[model samples]
Target: MFFALSKVLGFFALPSNLMISIGLVGALALFAGWVRLGGALLVISVLTLAVLGLSPLGNILLLVLEDRFPKPAENDNRPVAGIVVLGGSFDTIVAGARGEVALNESAERLTVIAELAKRYPEARIVFSGGQGTLFYSGATEAQVAARMFESFGIAPERITLEDRSRNTRENAVFSRDLVNPGAGERWLLVTSAYHMPRSVGCFRAAGFPVDAFPVDYRTRGYEDMTRPFRSVGEGLRRVDIAVREWVGLFVYRITGYTDALVPAPL
Candidate 1:
């Protein structure tokens, strides 16, 4: 139920969708002869679009989330029992059709996994993801990840694929159960930097303590303020992702899926 609601609400929450919705409301109001109200709404919509697209607000907003978890120190030599990589890295349908893996913007999730696999050859490799789309009847993300991992020279014996999970919570719960690490064994949770807080919280909530290995940063740091906006479409897309992640954190905390609104490193 949560998954379905999130999907429907997510569409409406997108900046583009919100703009269209407000415009539609204004159109209906004008048709009903509420001229002032309609005009005000229309103006507000345009201003909102400009603020989100032309300004650095989107990057600033994303920076807050992205900065919550920093990249782990490269020199730290901790014993890792395994590495768990989340989904959202591949287009399962495209991969299934083309007989090749097609990574999305979050391809760093997989690439990092490959590098980590080589760094810790003795540690287990787990990929968690399932069929997340509502109607796409194609290969699961885990299936595609398995093939990709194999291509990266990670032996099949070292990989554990949890392909039944549909969301972040499921990723933690399902992967924890699949791996079932021993006492004092530490696992590294790899996901996008913007997504690490929620991912870590969910893993801790599921009784799986993991060292965060955040990657795929979307923001260029505080310096993004000086950078020019390359495209309005890209800015809006970043806003959408930031908004969804913020909402996910809030919802997860309230529902006890996480122990904190924003989990921090210990």
Candidate 2:
């Protein structure tokens, strides 16, 4: 129930979608001869879209979340017990249809596994992801990632696919139940940099302590604060991603899915 409601509300929560919705309603109002209300809404919609698209607002918003958990420094030789890669990296529908691995913008989340696998040859590799789309269902992310991992030369024996997780909370809970990490075992949690805070919070709440291995960074650094996107679509997409993460963090915290409102490195 919560999942369905969140999915529905999440659509309107995106600034791009919300602005378009306002514009549509405004057009309908104008057709009905409600000039004052219609004009106000239309102006609001256009102005909001312009600000979100042309300005550096999207980059600025994303930088906050991207900078929350800095990617762990390299050269650490600590023994790793496992590596857990969260979902949202692959285009499962396309992969299923095309008979190949089709990765999205978050491909780094999965691609980094190749490097990690070589670095920690004995570490257990776990891919947690199920069917995330509300209507479409075909090959799961884990199924697609399996093909990719095999292409990366990772042994099938070392891979564990938890294909039931549909969200970050589920990823944490399901992966923990599957791995059952020992007290001293070190595990790395891999996901997009902008999503690390919420992912870490969920893992922590699930009693799973894993070091953050943030990948698929959307921003360079603080310098990106003033940098604007080249296109409206690109800018709006960035804003949507950043806003969704912020909203997810808030909702997860309030719902007790995570204890931290903004999870930090531990």
Candidate 3:
């Protein structure tokens, strides 16, 4: 029930979807002769879209989340018992059809596998992801990741695949159950920079304490805060990503998925 509700509500909650819906509704209202109401809605829709798509607001919002958890220091030599990489780095639909591993914009989540494998030869690796779409598809993200890992020459015994989890919370819960790391052992969580806060919160809430290994940063740094996007599509995409994450963070906290509103490094 929670998964279904989250998916449905999440669709409408996206800034792009909301703005597009408003524009469509306004068009329909104008067609029905609701002049004043239609004009107001249309004006609001256009202005909101312009602000989201042309301004630096998205970068500013993303920076707040991305900067919440920094990448582990270069000199912090720590023993990692295991590593967990969340899904959403692959395009399961394309991969399933083509029989080839296809990565999306979040490919860094998977590309980092090679570096990690070299760094921690002894650490067990867990890849957690399942079909997240409302409609059932034969493809699973974990399967695609498995192929990629094999191509990377990672040892089979060192890798564990948890393919049933469809969201971040389940990724943490299922990965923890699958590995059951020893107390005080360190585990590294690899995911996108903007997603680290919620990802960390979920793992912490599930009693799995893992250090953040953030990758796939969308923003350069504080400098991006003042820069406007040249392409409206690019800006809108960033805004959608940032807004969705912020909404997810709030929803997760209020729903008791995690005690922290914004999980910080220990």
lDDT of 1 by residue, 94-204 (tens): 988888889999999999877898788899999999999876777899989988898899888999999999999999999988888787998888999999999999999
Across 35-88, the per-residue lDDT of candidate 3 in tens digits comes to 888888899999999889999999999999899998888887788888999999
Better of 1 and 3 by TM-score: 3
lDDT of 1 at 84: 92
Model 2 alpha-carbon miss at residue 144, Å: 0.5
Q: How many clashes (backbone N, Cα, C below 3 Å) per candidate?
A: 0, 0, 0
For lDDT, the strongest prediction is 3
| Candidate order (lDDT) | 3, 2, 1
Q: Which 10-residue window in model 1 sums to the lowest lDDT?
A: 225-234
Model 2 lDDT per residue over 172-236, tens place: 99999998989988999999989999999999999999999998988888888888788888888
Clash pairs (backbone) in predicted model 2: none
Hey, what RMSD does candidate 2 come out at?
0.9
Runs in model 3 lying further than 4 Å from the true structure? 136-138
